[model samples]
Target: MADPVILVDRPAAHVARLLINRPDKRNAIDHAVRQQMAAALSALAGDPDIRALVLGGVAGVFSAGGDLPSMKGLDEAGARARMAHIHGLCRQIAEASLAIVSAVEGIGAGGAIGLALLGDEIVVGEGTRILFPFLRLGLTPDWGQLLTLPRRVGLPAARRLLIGGGPVDGAEAFRIGLADEVTADGQVMTRAIERASALAQLPRDALLRMNRRLEMPSATLSDELAREADDQARCLTGAEFNEGYEAFLARRTPDFSHL
Candidate 1:
């Protein structure tokens, strides 16, 4: 069956809106959601007319990262597999040619935070909650969060989030360089599009080149590439990853079998 976690719409000439549609779960990532997000990104990569994309979640939520229930019963192998796929999506967004703008309202956590950080420009709503709850759960980071967050917000700040459970608000996110702009509630998506529309007007080739520069890993390129592969394999085997996938298929919470 087709993945149902994402909803896509193109309302403007060169702008595409890809909304995370699983509000009931706070737009948490499951296997289905991950597949849909990757597919949507792949489709956008080939659409020449689409110059910019806006990613957000329905209601007030952005995403809470992986569904906890899915992590409940995963073995080490299952967790590693899940991590690999999540990291792949993060890399795909980073390498995509078209500009991406993230409109974050509330709750950007775990892999969800990685997705938002992939944006060339991120616009966040005032008072929105952004956190990285990985260390809190005794899980190593995945989804390019380990690799990208420190680059964008600095290592010290990244550690603060990764190690200390956070519910960082929008203003602080901007102060720490996590957000490009902070808009009033309900205005994030519109503001993000306005910026994206301007970006869409630029020459495509120039924009793409700039995107590549901004996304290039400052770390040794080979190291980053290897790290991506390594992290993915580890995540795939984790018991949490398996549990999460099973819960998603069964439509229930994960049983935390790996722990």
Candidate 2:
């Protein structure tokens, strides 16, 4: 039998940890992983004993983003549906009463970067890399990044990342406000759990309300989610995406000059 893609454990009385276990694929989020995460997070949200949650990935690597093979042949409608499922998972994280932390060790790229940002506090390993390569793939940002990135890193930095596809290391991530804390190599999960433990001791209702107040203003979550779907659908159906996908599979730089 195959190993479960998502692993749940209660490391402390008030803390739950959700580990993405697909290290063989760099913990890429496929349909099964998405469904499993959604179910696990939903259950955690309703557990009164769980005051905090830590999300991490196996083998020192966080997610590499969406499983490209799973997305290879998707049409516009299919792309939108897939993104919507991911959006639901993000919504679960955002709305959960439990304080959430992302223990980022390795790469958190593309949509996975968005997932990391969903955390109330992101603990990053010193060597970890965070990037958004959506433009390189000829795709728009999805998974509510359009809403969350600016709130974390401000509008100008967000534009540089989303448009220029630049990458940031843990130190740079902290300097730019993209990461809440940076720890020594291999210590991200430990630090994240420590932070979660501290957060768990706070008044739950007050914590939830404070999180809500910190949320990005001027647009509802649903509105930004809808915009993400629409924009991704448009890009997914374009010829440029085809070129980019092919180049990715061939391990070569894509030529987009003609597009």
Candidate 3:
């Protein structure tokens, strides 16, 4: 069999670390990776010995985004199906009893940005980059990003990111509430492990209940995810998305003036 796309490491009895293993592809989330991750997360959630989970990428990169190559010939229906899979993954993370933490090193762009925000606590390296480039791709945010973004940085800041298409460094990430802590470059994973260990020592039942309660006031995650899928499906079939996707492949700026 081929190597697994997601690696699970149990450094401590109560802590489980899930590492995105496609380093050569910048850990882009593709269909296979998504499936593997879902399986791993499910198993971890069912493990009574695990109380906290850390999500990160191999090497210094978190993830680039969805695999564009895998998306080349998708239609509106195909796009919706693909996004729904990602939404399911997000739902799994949100409902898991374990305290989730994200350890970001290099960058988390597009869909990866949404994935990182799923963490209850996020630790980033000083040089880490965070970006939301949905507009540039002529697509709306998916993976429940629309809900999570505002929850992390408030409405104003989230608007700037989704509209401006610029990248934010770790310092800004922390200041703007996107990150819980920042450490020296190359030390993100270590710091994340430490944080996870601390979370593991907390009263498990109380912590799990508190996490669920915190999510109660927000719009239901499932409904928001469905809305995102609808919007993304429409955008995927539009002319603007064609131009944007083509420009990305050609490494040129997308011209959306006509659209």
Candidate 4:
């Protein structure tokens, strides 16, 4: 049997690592890879043991995006199906409550950029290239990137990057707020996994609640005050908070492993 295109590994307790295993193809996401990715993410989402995820790629390369060769010779229906398939994958990542970190070493292109941006935090190497070549191909950006990009880089920068813009290297990406952190090529994956592990140390339910609020920020101060009231009420009454309070007085790190 062939090796899986997406390799799932448990690098740490409560943390899963997904390695895109297509170095010869520059980690291009073909249809098969998309399907596999969706399934893997869904499984991880359902796995109560997993609290966070780190997405990396083989050969120090992230992904070259959709494989153009595999994308050719598609009828209208086939094309739509392809888009819908990838959309499902993108939706899975976007809606996931698990803290996700993406390690971009070489390049993150096209649809892959959308996937990378879906991460709660992105770690890019100094030589990493972030590409958005939608216009060059005469296609509007897909994979929910139109929404994710703006959420990451704000409207003006997102607009500029998406419309007739060239690729942005790691430095430019960091300057534009596209990347949460930047590291040397050799350290990108380590940084990403470390970030995910750190997030995993917190209470999972709290992260889910926070993700809910972030997904829908309040438009007014009163609304935000009500939201915070709801958040604090739920948290303060939880066992995690009880332990945390006791730990604060005891001057020790709270052990949230059981929670």
Best of the candidates, lDDT:
4
* 202 Cα displacement, candidate 3 (Å): 1.3
Query: Per-residue lDDT for 1-259 in model 2, tens only?
Result: 9889999998775889999999989999899998999889878777778888998899998889888899998899998898789878888888888888888888888878888788798988889988788989988998889889998889999999888786689999999999999999778988889998888766565456446655743278887677557655766777667877898999987654344
The estimated TM-scores of all candidates read 0.80, 0.82, 0.81, 0.93
Question: In model 3, where do residues sit more than 4 Å from their true spots?
Answer: 218-259
| Model 2's TM-score against the true structure | 0.82
Pairs of residues at least 3 apart in sequence or in different chains that clash in candidate 4: none
Candidate 2 residue-wise lDDT at 30: 93
Query: Candidate 2 regions off by >4 Å?
Result: 216-259
Instruction: Compute the lDDT for candidate 4.
Output: 0.87
Global fold similarity of model 1 (TM-score): 0.80
RMSD of 1: 15.9
For 21-115, candidate 1 gives per-residue lDDT tens digits of 89889999888887888999899888877888888888878888888998888898998888788878877888787778888887788878888
